[model samples]
Target: MNAESPNIGAPQRPVIRQLSEDAANRIAAGEVVERPASAVKELVENALDAGAQRVDVTYADGGKTLIRVADDGCGMTAADLPLALSRHATSKIDGSDLLNIHSFGFRGEALPSLGAVGRLVISSRAEGFEGAQIAVTGGAIAAVRPAALNRGTVVELRDLFHATPARLKFLRTDRAEAQAIADVMRRLAMAAPYVSFTLRDVSGGEAREIFRTDAEQGELFGALAGRLARVLGRDFADNALPIDAEREGLHLTGFAALPTYSRGAAIEQFLFVNTRPVRDKLLIGALRAAYMDVLSRDRHPAAVLYLACAPELVDVNVHPAKAEVRFRDPALARGLIVSALRHALAGAGHRASTTVAGETLGAMRPEGPRVYQMDRPSGGAIRSAYAWQAPIFAEAPAPFAAAPEPAPEAVNYPLGAARAQLHENWIVAQTADGMVIVDQHAAHERLVYERLKRQMAESGVAAQALLIPEIVELSPADAAR
Candidate 1:
């Protein structure tokens, strides 16, 4: 061996041993408790599963210092409190089967995993039983004791990620975390319209309610529409198209925004499967394809869509966070969404309100024709016009037989009556509500495209290349392929 070269030994043998329950829970917390928002999601899900019609969430320091979720739900008994803080002790499911899961937080990992990383207190009073409470701090279990409560359950978490200080470093600023918490609340609120939700921001000893909504009951769609209007705003409701479609036991319902009322980003799009909000690629792609034709490439349509199907048809356990799912028939899911929404959007034109929005979108283009600029009268009430391509706009054939202008009644087409032709390529017309300016060449292009489509459908399009034939070598090393 060289003088400076030290002796090398074999790698140490790996040890295979089981992890302690506390250690396992802490590991699970790494997956479950990603941030303060994750803790909020897990806690809220538990409350919803408890059959709470009203849920109130309050947090301070973006949930790092304190997070409390109180719900008027069916509370637990004294014996259940300690088990509720233990790992894998759940009342939501029986070990008899896993396929029958309908409840939201069924993994039985949320409470224990949360307890593993933070200080947790759960207090509940089931009907006909005395209220009880249990406290757990960093996987250390506390005795279950009698506690007073009106009804339902109350869970409070403090000093989140205290046991795992590294997680605190991963958390964003208070404002950002607060915004994320608000987003989580919004999604949950949209999912369960029948349930009331109140979210509060209690920072610096000041209590500020950030969001509040009362429970909506009665007809599903009626209540949902009212809730939607409240959450999404009246403008979105005004432009939204309602969709209720079903096929092969897969039901889809909710509202879709018109192409005319599109957005630059997809933040406004909300999707739910069986009342669980998810942002899946399959669902998003289906929606994108649904609006592919009516909406421009750069714009995204806003919507709050819901999907309902049998439990067996979808798997919600694919992710630890349960924010995504795997469908039994992805193609069917995609088809149902795309076809139903497209059909609804196509018919929504009739239900649309008579507004200047359509005219405004059409008038954004440059005023001049491609080749020439007609002298425009300035500072006058510019009449709305529609672009028309009918041959009547053409000049008279005979120099001495110039055609007199058509009667104003003749300009009653959808685009409005044609007014004048500019550069023989553009038409300006007037409509009952607004005016349109048409491009003759663009209209001709569409016409040609439709003609080609029809022809191609009848007899497949034939391909012909214009490249000259040249053969140098059978297998040239410089070949592009």
Candidate 2:
């Protein structure tokens, strides 16, 4: 009868084992370098962090077959080569300090992960040492040997996804991949206008002068505009409005297109943070909302908005690709975008343009004048001989008099030079068909809605609260839905 004698035992737990260095590196590489473009991004970031003034990216067959990034920055010494490939190894930050990251790339797994998945060769030379070469294939390291090279690093990757053919199958076409690579390069070029970039396609023998900036000038906006004009097209420069605003310790600066100058696609909306290009849904949503009143729903605005703030306020490690980010105060970020863009558009006197086409038929007569008659009082007395010429008829002549005045031939007035804009919102005009009524506000609403839906489908929506409370009294069922 002893209820306290029940058996008690500790539950067994499964033991976890750390993966081997090679396996770990490969796993990390899977996250960092999902495709050849990702590898290119990581290597370029390293070169930029090394203070490289010029970066050259060459690739073949959409970078699946080969990719090489060469930079004219301070190259790694012979001793640093091995350390650079090791996991969790980086010269940028010391241990116990993960909050403040000044370099574009501080994670040291990029090179090794790439090496694990494919063939990787790194050649470099420091200021006062002979050039050195290090090679790795399928996570196997080769001996470092002396080689002839310049005063920088050249990282080459070949036969990507050869060890993992499954990953290769997910890749897009060669042209599409090449375009993605170019897009990545263009964004980076926009972020760092002081750096020079060159991209070449070895397979098609095509080359592009992606970016070139004058170091002495040191004008980020001008250089960005020039580069954007070169890469995106010249029309963007003509239609874009400059953005400069600050709020809640965050500074927003860049160019946004006028409502009249929107695009059918959002491929031109480039966003950057602390000189690094990113694609965050909240930011994109805020951008769409800012232009909602001006742009049509099916269209997207051309913009390049740079957001600068303390690193602690934003977390860039939310995604392995570093494309998306989480902000400590997302509302502040959204407000910055909406207010900055709204101010810029208003200052630019943004307006929608419209056109109409039609062919004239023939002349037509104007309608006869409308007439009204009143009932006469009961007859009082007979008066003069001109009784028929009463007061009403005294000021007008008979319609059938004088043989109908030769039946005056019909005439036309050519709809008289379409009326000008009424109150800046409505446009009044006359046509042979009928009068036309246009609601500027409603038209713009439709436009913005379509655009927002499209953007949400492509990149997701960014929601922000109104600065002022937006109160509404709705029925219970409707509110719940």
Candidate 3:
């Protein structure tokens, strides 16, 4: 050993001792409860896993001082309260098979981890059982006692990260964290369209509703559409195309937006694996690949896609928070998404998204002030002026008097008939509801490109044999390269 070594006289043998249960739980909290949003995600997911029909979440000061989640879900019994706060205790799965997980939680770490870091209270009343409540502060459990409740469970967590104040330093601003919480709720709501969700913010003794969606009714797609309309807005619901496709054992279902309705950032893309929301790179890559041709590189396609398969085919235990998964056949899943979205987009044909018309109308709105119907000429006065011009129309030249070419018969076509051209580039067409202004060069380029692609698809690649075959012999090692 060097004489100047810092550990020259230190003990040769190290002593190892088991960490206290409370200390161990705090360590686990470091992994499970990173921020307010993470805590919200775990609690909400637990509620959903417990067969919740409706979930209500409220937070204060970005969940630093207060956070509460009440769910109309199957409640736990008094005997289960203490166990639920123990490490590695969960009702979501058996210890036998990890690959076949169907719920959002399995490791049984979220509740205990949360209790270790916050002042946690769970009150509940199960069917055929009396109401009970349990409280834990900084990993110190209190005796279970009778409490008042209704049909489900209410979990209240106050002063989160109170035990480990160091973790609080990593939190973002209150507004940003609240937005993150809302984002989590939105993803879960989208995942389970049939379940209702309400999120509220309670700060400074005032309760403000942030987001709410009632349970949707009807078939899967219909319910999903209604839920989407409520959650993602009517614009998305109207512009999105329905996607239903299957390959091998995987079934893909969701709505994908039209290329014309794409966004500048990848904000609205939501992917789920067997009803569990996931942020997987493989699925995102597949979505981008599907729309690579229709959308520019700077634009991102918006979609909400769900991939369903046998539970055993995908492993959901890949991450601590269950945000990622491992697919038994990643290629198969990727190919299914890519093919389904591409097929849907291809089948949309020449249809323009409603967002385009909305944007056009918005842009055409006048900025000037004060114009009312009463300020304009009366309808009878306009009719009388038209009657005065009738004889002038009758005295017009023969070319002008030939019924004006029947107004170009604007009937079936959405673009109606090409009425005029301007600057040798813009083509103006009349439609039933309104007029369409198109860039002639851009439209022509797109039409030509589509035609070329169609021809290529029809004729296949022209194949011809090489005039002369030139080959070189290689050694065994070089041939492998």
lDDT of 3 by residue, 329-385 (tens): 999999999999999988886455664543333332334577887788898969866
TM-score for each model: 0.74, 0.72, 0.78
The candidate that wins on TM-score is 3
- Global CA lDDT of candidate 3, please? 0.85
**Model 2 shows how many backbone clashes?**
6
lDDT of each: 0.81, 0.77, 0.85
**Model 3 Cα displacement at 100 (Å)?**
1.8
Q: Give the top-scoring candidate (lDDT).
A: 3
What is the alpha-carbon RMSD of candidate 1 to the true structure? 16.7
- Write model 2 residue lDDT over 35-121, tens digit each, in one string: 778988998999999999999999988899899999989998999888887887898888566657777886677888998889999
Looking at candidate 1, the ten consecutive residues that score lowest on lDDT are: 472-481
Q: Using TM-score as the measure, name the better of candidate 2 and candidate 3.
A: 3
lDDT of 1 by residue, 251-337 (tens): 999999767567789878999999988989999999999999877899898889999999889988888888888999999999999
Model 2, residue 466: C-alpha shift (Å): 54
Q: Clashes in model 2: which pairs? A: 285-462, 296-447, 297-447, 297-450, 297-451, 298-451
